[model samples]
Target: MSVARTLFRLTLLAGALSPGLAHAAGLDGSQLSLLWALPFAGLLLSIALFPIVAPEVWHHHFGKISLGWALAFLLPCALWLDPATAGGVVVHAMVDEYLPFIVLLFALYTISGGILITGNLHGSPVLNTGLLALGAACASLMGTTGAAMLLIRPLLRANDNRRHNVHVVVFFIFLVGNIGGGLTPIGDPPLFLGFLKGVSFAWTFSNMLLPVLTACLILLVVFYLLDSHYYRKEGVLPRDPTPDNARLGIQGVFNFALLAGVVGAVLMSGMWQPGLDLNVLGVKVGIQNLLRDGILLTLAGASLALTPTTLRDANEFNWGPIAEVGKLFAAIFITMAPAIAILRAGPQGDLAALVALVSSADGSPINPMYFWLTGSLSSFLDNAPTYLVFFNLASGDATQMMTEYSATLLAISAGAVFMGANSYIGNAPNFMIKAIAEQRGVPMPGFFGYMGWAWVFLFPLFVLLTLVFFR
Candidate 1:
C-alpha cells in the first residue's frame, strides 16, 4: 500500500502560525508552471534510455544520475521556493512515501526469498500459464507485491531451461504485477486509498469483477498461445538445471507468517487511527504509520535473521534490485511531487486544460476520458495518488461515487489498476520482476521495448474495454 491517507493532510495549525511557511510547505499547483515537470521527465527518460545507450554507465552510476535529477528539482525549490519548503518536501518524500513503500517491498522480497518451492516442474506452456493464473489469484489476497515476490523465483526456476521464455516473464508482469490487483482494496495501493476515503471494502471486488476477469482471460489466452509457439520453436530445451526430481514441497514455512505480518501492518496503518500525530519538523507523521513501518522493518530483519542463509542462497536472494529501485524511485517520488500537485490542483492548475477534458462544460464526468486520462497518468505517475486525484475529481463522496457515479468510479479503478501494465514504472512490481528476470539471465526488454510489448498486446483490449464498459 502507499502512504496512509492522513500523510497528505499535514497539520495546518503549524502552517497557520506561519503563513509564508505554510505556502512554501504545501506547493500550490495552480501557481506552478508546466516547466516544473522537466526534472521528472528527465529522470524518467534517463531510466528508460540509459540502460540501452550505456549499460555499463547505468549499472555503475544510476544512483548518482537519479540524485542529480532529484537535485534539479530540489535546488530550485530551495533557492526560489524556500528552504523550509524544500526541506519539508524532501522529508515528506522520504518519510511519507518512499520509506513505507520500500519497507513493504523489502519485507516481501526478503520473506518470499526464504520460501523455497522445491521441485523440478517443467516450464511447459500449460504449466507456466497455470503459474501465472495462480499468482494472479493470490494477488488480490496478499497484494501485487506479495504475490509477485512469492511466486517469481519459482516461475523463473521452472523456466530456467527454456531459451525463449522472456515472453513468459513479460506476461507474468502483465497479469500478476498489474491486472491481478484490480479486484480488492488490499490488492493495490489505489483501492486501499479508496477504502481509506470511505469506499466500502467489498466495492472494488464487486464492481471490478468483470473488468478484472476480462483482462485476466485475454492476457492468459494470448500468453498461452504465444508460449506454446515458443515451446514448439525452441524444442529440445537445454538440460534442466534443477532436475533433482525430489518431491515438490514448500520450505521455510515460517516466512509465510512474516508475510501475514506484513499484510497486517499495512491494514492496521490504514484502518486503525490513534489520532496522535508525531510532529517531525512541520509535517505531522501519524503514529500508527510509524508503528506500521517499525513492524515492517522488524519483520524484514526477523526474516533475515531467522530464515537460514542457505535458503536465501538457494533462492538467489540479492538486494541489488531493491536498492536500485529505492534510489531511482526516491528521485521519482520527489521530482514528480510538483506534477502530482498540479493534478491535485484540479481546474485551477497550469494543467487546467488537460483536467478540463475529464468533464464537459456542464461538469458531467466523461467516462471514457476518465479511464484513458487516469490510465495515461497512472502509467507514468504513482497509480495510488493518481487514483486519489480522480477520486476527488469525480466526487470524493463514497456514497455518491459508489452509486449514481459508479460507472466513473469503475473507469478510474480499471485505469489505475489495468493500465499499470503499460510501463515498468507504472507500478513498483513491474520493474522488480524485470530486474530479477534479467539477473537470472533472461533477456528482458529495455523500458521502451517493454512498452512495445504492451502496445502490441494490451491496446486492443483497452479499446474493447472502453467500448463495452466505459461507453
Candidate 2:
C-alpha cells in the first residue's frame, strides 16, 4: 500500500481503538492535577529552546517534535479517560478550533503570495520611516503577515546599500509585524480568534484605535529618530541599486480584491449566523463557519489558478511557514486543552493560583495584570492560544467582555497583539520576517538579542499604554 494510504489506515485504526479502551468518562479540570500540564510545558520549551540549541534538527523535524508532544497528551488521555471522551476531545479540537485557524492562515498565505511589489526606492531616513508607517497602516487592511511579506523585500532592497540597517528591520517588526496588527481582527491571529469566539468585527478597531495609534506613532517616531542618527553617522549616502529611472509599481494587483473577499467572508460568518450547525464528534460546526472556510479555500484556489505563477515566484512565496504553523498549532491546540480547561475551571482548578493572580483580593479584575500576564506569556508562547486562555480567565462570554468587562477585553487584545513584538517567537510573522531578512543578508539579532531590543523599546511603551489605557 502507498504510504499515504497506510498512514490514513493507521489513523482510522487508532481512532477506532481509542473508544474501546475508555477508562473514565471525561476530564474534569478541577479534579485533575497539575501533572496534566506537562505536555504543554514540554511543547512550549521545545518551541523556545530547540531552534536555538539545535537549529538543524529543529529545521528538519520540529513537526515531529510537536506531534510527539501531542501524543504525550493524547495517549495518556486515551488510556485514562473514557474512549468516547478522549476521541471526542481530539475530534472537537481538530474540527472546531484547529481547522478554521489553519485554513484562514492558508488562505491568507496563498492569496498574499500572489501579490508582488517589484521596484525599490532609496531608503532615506524619511523614506524608510514612511514605508514603515505605510506598512503599519496597511497591516490592519491586509494583515501583518501580508504587509510584512509584501513590503519587506522592497524595504530591504531600498536599504541594501546602507551600512547600519539592522535597526530598520527591527523597527519593521516592531511596527508592522506586531503592533500594527492591533487595530483589526483580520490584522492578527489572536484578534481573529477573538472574532471567531464572537467578538464583533468592528469591536477591535473601535476599542483598539487609540492604543494601536499611540503605540505605532511612538514606535515610528523612535524609528525615524534612530534611522536619522544612523543616516548622519554614515558620512556619505550609498548609491541607489535600482536605476534612478526605474519606476515603482505593484505586479499582481488583482489579489487585492481576493484579499477583500477573504475579509468579507470572515465578516459574513460573524454577522450572518443562520442558527444552523452540524454536530460532529460532539462539536457544533456552524454552517456560517463552514461556508466561510469554503469561501476562503475557493479564494485561495482562485489566486493560485488565476494569478501568474511567475508573480508568486517573484514574491518568493512558499508553503513552509504556513505548514510549520499548521503542524505546531495542531499540537498546541490539543495539548493546551487541559490547560484551557483548568483555566476555565477558575478558582477550583489546580491552576487556581495562576488564575487568581489576575484578580485582586476584592475579586475585582485587575486590568493591568491582565495586560502584562497575557502579553508576557504571549511573548513566549503562541499569542493566539494565550489570548484564548486569558479570555476565558477574564470571563468567557463575548458579550459580557464587550460590555461589562470591556477594559479587560481591550487589555487582553492589546497585550496579545502589541506585545507579540517582544520576541521573535511572539507572532508568526516576526520570525519569518527575521528569516527573510537574514536570507537577504541582513544581520538580524539572535533570540535573546532581539528581546533586549524589545525590552529597551517596547516595554516602556507598554507601560505607558497600561498607565493611560489599561489602568
Candidate topping lDDT: 1
1-471 per-residue lDDT for model 1 (tens digits): 122222223223233334344334877788899899999999999999999999999998888888888779878987898766766666667666777788888888888888999898889999999999999998998899899989999999999999898899999999999899889888889898898888887888999999999889989999999999999999788899886766699999999999889889988988998899876645578999899989998998998999898988988989988877877888898899999999999889988888899998798999999999999999999998999999999999999999999999999999999999999999999989988998999999999999999999999989999998998
Q: Write the per-residue lDDT of candidate 2 for residues 393-417, one digit (tens) a residue.
A: 8889999999999999999999899
Clashing pairs in 2: 22-83, 24-82
Per-residue lDDT value at 292 in model 1: 91
For residue 232, give model 2's deviation from the true position in Å.
Answer: 3.9
| Segments in model 1 whose C-alpha atoms lie over 4 Å from true places | 1-24
Worst 10 residues of 2 by lDDT: 2-11
The models' CA-based lDDT, in order, is: 0.87, 0.82
Best by TM-score: 1
Model 2: per-residue Cα lDDT at residue 344: 61
Off by over 4 Å in 2: 1-27, 82-86, 192-203, 233-244, 395-400
Error of 1 at 436 (Å): 0.7
